[model samples]
Target: MLGERILLGPGPSLVPPEVTAAMAAPMVGHMDPDLFPVLEETARLLRQVFQTANELTLAVSGTGTAGMEATLLHMVKPGERLVVCSAGFFADRLIEIGGRIGAEVVRVEAAWGRPIDPADLERALGRLGGGRTTVAAVHVETSTGVLHPIADLARVAHAHDAAILVDAVASLGGADLPTDAWDLDACYSGSQKCLSAPPGMAPVTVHTRTRGRFRPATFYLDLEGLWTYWGAPHGYHHTVPVSLVYAMREALRLVAAEGLPARVERHRRMTRALWAGLEAMGLELLVPEPHRSPTITTVRIPAGADDAKVRTRLLREYSIEIAGGLGPLRGQIWRIGLMGYSCQPKWVLALLGALEAVLTAEGVRLPKGDAARAAAARL
Candidate 1:
């Protein structure tokens, strides 16, 4: 029954058989000699995947949100000035977390389905008068399927002597993000979205320059403390999620085997095929082409069509699952993901074919068999 349903939603997308099997490997103590090599190898693979030489990269024992909290808590102190660029729901989360950490949060807002403008970020920095500010932005806004420009924003942040933190939760492995080349100070992501692992670990990397500024606040979420323990004499900080790490190690190994460039190209190709198919079906894309994320696409539901009804039919009839929009765009758009193992020609074709059938059954006027034909032509 579980195998019958297709996962076309935003996250917790399809996990590969190798990754799933790795999780079932015999478990050992978190600090066992056998597991240390696995931890070390996981860090090495993550660094290669993230395209960073930073020594502080490791997996936090929670979901992507935990990585966000850990990065924010360690970096921002009480009464510090923080600037956030919120283009969608997840970016708004940065502002909320900053506020909770007692930072004087200043937000630069953009409309949903659009990327944050670099000029706006520059203007906000200019207004701040070059004081110490923690600049935060989302690398990929999953809710609206928009990819924000991190390189330009990082330059604006650095010009003001600020550290830039990015939420790459939805973009990391599936998207081509060169952390060092982009000058990103800190970035965090999840295993489930692009890594094709179970949703348990959050991979985080903090540059040495950024790591020096953070003092430990909470013991467990304190990245600096974790670094000290994980790095040097190997003191025990907390019980690491052993099985999840095993799974993440396997996921990274798969990414490494595929090669980053090939993996990235695969995602781009699948996304392009998906866009072409959806466009052929007369389904409008929420984000413009330039800002669309490769891993996820949000398609606008036609006026007078019931979004929930179509989604239900897709699930019950075709055994396919795609997400509805969240927050302001709820019920107006369908969020479909082509991520990790799910980003393939077979899945793309399957989703388009099923969606075409569902939309046609609901009396929407689409060219007969257009979606499937377009996808096949692309393939």
Candidate 2:
């Protein structure tokens, strides 16, 4: 049997026991009467976590990328313009998906580890010059561990008369994102990250501004078709995963119980401690202080350290799991995630200790106990 790992990677953070138990409940039919209320309550709780009163809020049957596709497909028609704020790997995904859907995709890029300047977005919108464009951005770039400014970008998109779509796959419940307050037209996230559920459902919330107005090219990912099953008459578009819905609802319930504000603070606090510890151990972080993500941190691997070897040692020796970098950053950095049930001081300290031991064994020089002391001081 495989040992249970301390999931400190980019996604599918540790699931709490309550959510696991909810998934174990007896399965119900997609159109069953008992299932509708659970779906209704789940949508309601999702609205709470998303901090929006949008009536179209609900969980889609796929992962976070599914939500991205749905949002872009509905918001931007074929042959229309989509201004993407590209800074990291996921932002590139927005560009790729937009191109595949037949939209005129424009990219406004920044350094991978930095936030997008609202001025840059304004300029991109200015070049597009009017008619029905959608501005897409990533709230938290999972690849580089940078938190882009969604609220600021939203304001710029609105000023230029364009809709805004946000990829909150890494932020959502873990970070401070006010959907309605920021006037974001569409937003989506995966259940596996900050929501602490299994890796299946994608919780999406679309503002009523464009609700039921446009038909997407995709039949299955259509927002109108989805909301139809999620709300009113309760029609069936696809066979909703009853077990995954149960897990998602229970996870959202836990979010409500802890309160979003408290949960966000916990993520922030834990990340700060982790950062202090990593720096104390003579490590350099990829993203600077201002633009760093609270949920995922990117650390620069020191010279002579083997990225895959270090991560393998952590998993094999300590049963801890972290991730390596992606794309051009591969072999250059490590991605450590602090999210949901896994974002706690104990796990942060455990990782620091284990990482230090691994580095020492690999002939990397570091003073023992410095990481723990620095992290504990913050805690």
Candidate 3:
């Protein structure tokens, strides 16, 4: 059962054997002399994968949610204003975390399955009367499979003298988001999504401009402390997960070897083929083609289909896995991920065939094997 899964769900993408094997090697001390070099190399590779020259790039313990909390709590202190442009579930998550941290949270929301518009953000700040502020947004909303343009949004945030923070949990590594080139102040992403690693580590990058500006609210997630441990002085902040580090390093190596542009292109190519197959089955996409995300695709559940039944059949009958929608979109759409190692022709074709069979089994009438033929034509 070494490679038994077809992990086509929204997250925790299929982990390649290389990454898992790296984790299986002998575990080492967090601060051991021999291990420091591995840590340094990991940091270097992280910067490359993140597409940022920011000096604060490093992986935080826990999942992507931890990355979101650490970033907001660290940058937006108590009593500060955090303007969140919410489009889907993860965007709303930023608001929740910001409010819990004692920041004055203001929301500028878009309908689900759409990207956050920059004009709305400008209006939100204009109403806030614009001082030193923060604008938080989700770069690619995994819940809705929509991609937001970070560079334009960052421009508006800077115009209002605000630091722009983006949640790239679903977009990073698979999508083309140049953190430094786009002028993002900070961004965080999950290891399980596009990185094809385990679900514990969250990689985040911070700008050098905020180097000495503020201290982290939480001690364990303090950016300065984490940097000190990952970098110079090599001080011990806490016990780092050496095995996950190995897995993350191998994953990043895969990202590098495939080349960033080509990796993103592969994800996009698979997305197009998936869309062609789904559309040929008379299924509609939750989001429009222009705003669709390359990493995850959200499909509307047809009139005669039962979401749970279709998904269960896919799992039980085909041994394939896909996710149901989240938050407001729950039970309305199915989230299918084409990410990292899982984005390939074989996986795409397999899911299409499985979906066709399951939808028919669930009594949703459609031509048999149409999806597979359409997908083959595109692929």
TM-score of each: 0.97, 0.99, 0.97
Model 1, 258-280: lDDT tens digits are: 99999989999899999999999
Better of 1 and 2 by TM-score: 2
* Best TM-score among the predictions, by candidate number: 2
Clash-forming residue pairs, model 1: none
Looking at candidate 2, what is the lDDT of residue 362?
Answer: 100
Q: In candidate 2, what are the lDDT values of residues 1-379, reduced to their tens digit?
A: 9789899999989999999999899878999988999989999999999999999998889999898888888788888998999998999999999999999989999988889999998887887765788899999999999999899999999988889999999998899999999999999999999999999899899888876666778889998899999997799899999999999999999999999999999999999999999999999999989999999999999988999999999999999999999999999999999999999999999999999999999999886779999999998
Off by over 4 Å in 1: 1-4
Global Cα lDDT for candidate 1: 0.89
Q: How many clashing pairs does model 3 include?
A: 0
- How far in Å is the alpha carbon of 273 misplaced in model 2? 0.2
276: Cα error in model 3, Å: 0.6
- By lDDT, the better pick of 1 and 2 is 2
lDDT per model, in order? 0.89, 0.92, 0.89
